[model samples]
Target: MVSVAMDAVGERLVSRVERLRALEQALLKAGDRGVRPAELAQRLGVRRQTIYRDLQALADTDVPVWNPARGRWAVRQEQYVGTVRLSIHEAVALFFAARLLARMADEHNPHAISALEKLALRFPEPVREQAMRAAPLLERRPRNREFVQALECLTLGWIERRKVRVLYRSARGRQRHPYVLHPYFLEPTAPGMAVYVLAYEESYFRQFVTLKLERMSQATLLDERFPERDFDPVAALQSAWGIMWSSSPVTVRLRFSPTVSRRVRESQWHLSQQMEEKPDGSCILTLRIGHTLEVLPWIRSWGRDCEVLEPPELRSQLAEEYEAAARLYRTAATADSVSGLRPSSGRHPRL
Candidate 1:
């Protein structure tokens, strides 16, 4: 496994690339109306010197951009470029993410809503308002700074073809894997949800792990990076449910009460999830999870309303808990009865 230091450097490099791209876009839009360099910086809320450096960096890269006047700069129309088109699945994911951000008004981040508006610009006018309306129900957690940092480092390493050492803390707390991820994609899980770092955890085994930005502590990028490495993030998460990286796949089945059935059907828990109708008006939901631990708490939350019908292990766990609780109650009843009973005449004689 690679060292953790490389991950830090690589992330910084990726952030620089993205910053440059945004600056480049702003310059392209400035046009012959010729936005002043200072004004461009102001638009981006950055210092003038930073904007100047961006121009120099763009020039250094040999892009045909220049300062036409004392403070004005512009990129040739040919320099204007659009990002790759997103597939429908990606668009839907974005839609949900946009909705989640819109709801983050309570989190004191005006940017969440603003970001959603920016994304809406990509869709048609009619669809835009509808997407905005739908955003709140999909509101996700705010962007985690640590995860963002990890992602930034990973991106640079990928672009530079450098390897990074990630100090990962596993869920079990005992297994710490040094990850060598071939970074390619950044996907937002659900709408408005905090994004996760999707990369390959290369150690004794090569497997994909979604490292929550919040979970990684004391991350630093290394000088070594990876270039020309190819991997698909979607395919890696495709076989999984939620974020658990399961090597051996298992199918999970749940039956929910009628009251919660609509709620279950309305939202997707997994891509492979299939819905089966029960004659008794309950919802039978079936999906495969890489690790049952991820869904264990969720099942327990449903209380008496849900049942784990498949995956004998999961069922057994629930059963074990149920039996343990029953035994405890029975013991408690016996104790209560003994305590409530009047002292026997024999006890008075002994006293």
Candidate 2:
């Protein structure tokens, strides 16, 4: 009885393998004119009649297989040059990305919406309508219009292998830089709302400049070639929480209050963030970054609820910024009282 069961399993396995081979061959000969059943049977070492049965089984699933003229099989052009058979996971990811793009109508990227449109076109009518409906419900915060456009233009220049002349205004004032830089990527930052450009400034001895998008004034794309540099932007960015240090990547540790901990856990602030639960239900957030500036403001934003458990530079910097801000408020209050400025009772100043 056991021997008979084993024989049955072996036959099923062989049948499965034969069907897989036929499917693979159909895909391989997709653009080609046709494939013969006799040839397919010989390739799979199966009987010609078995090959015919397998073709029928494949056809039942709506795979576009055709027997042209005399028992020669062909994968139809619609199934060949047409729709991509993506796994459910891949389809969902595409759907998610498409949804994000459709909502970013404010973004000047022509390709963004176009790409989403192409993905929507791939789906059936009902799925397409569902995606379209979900798009309006997906809310994205408005980005700085000028900044977004400039970044998009720079990205185009990068793709076309062109240089850009930028009139950048730092904290001081405007400075012109006619540099050939390989544009890597951009990162979003908070408080006064800044977007930073991570690019290799070739004219400046191949130095990496993290320029604030808000500071860029006049940007012109130039027809200049950049000598390729042996640098990895991703690895460089790995040690950063913000646009600060680039010297060496180091481990950073922080303790968050229960409130802040809950908030931080729900969001991914850094690439290398790891959280540990404390005994008192608080959270210890550890991150590996190259710069101190990244975590400084984030810690300060938590007020006295967050503490830097490691990295002295970051802790001190946060302390100084907090002190500076406190002093500014103190001075403002004192001056207001001295000038007999009437305090607006109902209206609080929006921070």
Candidate 3:
């Protein structure tokens, strides 16, 4: 009698484990749109009461499973259950990357922060200790709250493939324009972690446009849905240098100094980039892309370390900018001299 009772207890434990595993799998597969208890029970070959008990067990473990609507059950955010082993170096690298992302993430959106928290929790004891000590070394700037809110609204539109109306302030001028947009994707832009929405304008030319979220005053998700059959954001950006796309493609050739050649070659600047190393240690990079304006600043960042070899128009534009910058500096120096406003030692005159 005692042996039979012990076997019964062991069987009950195994059954519970199996049921919990099935419940977790169901929740993971459901993703943002959560599975109903009835569906989960049916899929797991269990009763509704058993599924409810399993859900309660998950809740006890602090899983973010919740009912998003009246009857729809979904995870608040996607989560995984697994142990990820990372070396100290990998942990540090991930820590810094997470720090940068956290700085850029929307204040209203807790997804990135929650993910980082989970990652930190999974770190080995020694690495986690080191990370905690190094945490103060990383500085994070507060994100733009208003822009983050706008991003949340746009994200919903993109996820549902729904149309949205945005009151956007133009980048060229500060003019406000109302646009009916089919939000497709969000991309991070450089200089800073600025967010832009890649959407098809429904009201105007039915052309694609990238709107900066910071410039948007409001974004409202509409009830209308759009067919995403042929819309490929990746294909659309294939020829783009950065975010801007152009119908006309241009081949840009640049020569990098030997000092900066290795740095240039180390990074994949574009999909169509081809590099040729010269005997002198200098290198030439050629890229077949459109939207020269987007890459102009990047080229200029190398300064005297880089020279435009092809596309005479881009070279001329760079020359003009250099000349303009030099003129401004010379004017500023002259004014400083005339006004007896010579800066103190180690400090240059301000423009």
Error of 2 at 180 (Å): 3.0
Least well predicted 10-residue stretch by lDDT in candidate 3? 133-142
Candidate 1 lDDT, 219-253, residue by residue in tens: 56676544444566667667655566555778988
TM-scores, each model vs. reference:
0.52, 0.54, 0.75
**Over the stretch 88-164, how does candidate 3's per-residue lDDT look in tens digits?**
67766887777676555433345555556655765788766654543332224355656656777788778767788
RMSD of each: 16.4, 10.8, 5.2
CA displacement after TM-score superposition, residue 57 of candidate 1 (Å): 14
Which stretches of model 2 miss by more than 4 angstroms? 1-88, 95-107, 122-127, 133-153, 184-196, 212-223, 242-245, 258-269, 274-276, 320-351
Give one clash count per candidate, in the order shown.
Answer: 29, 2, 0
Model 3 stretches with alpha carbons more than 4 Å out = 1-15, 24-42, 58-94, 102-118, 124-143, 222-224, 246-249, 332-351
Model 3 accuracy (lDDT, Cα): 0.77
Error of 1 at 246 (Å): 4.1
Which lDDT value does model 1 have at 65? 82
Candidate achieving the largest lDDT: 3
Q: Judge candidate 3 at residue 236 and give its lDDT.
A: 67
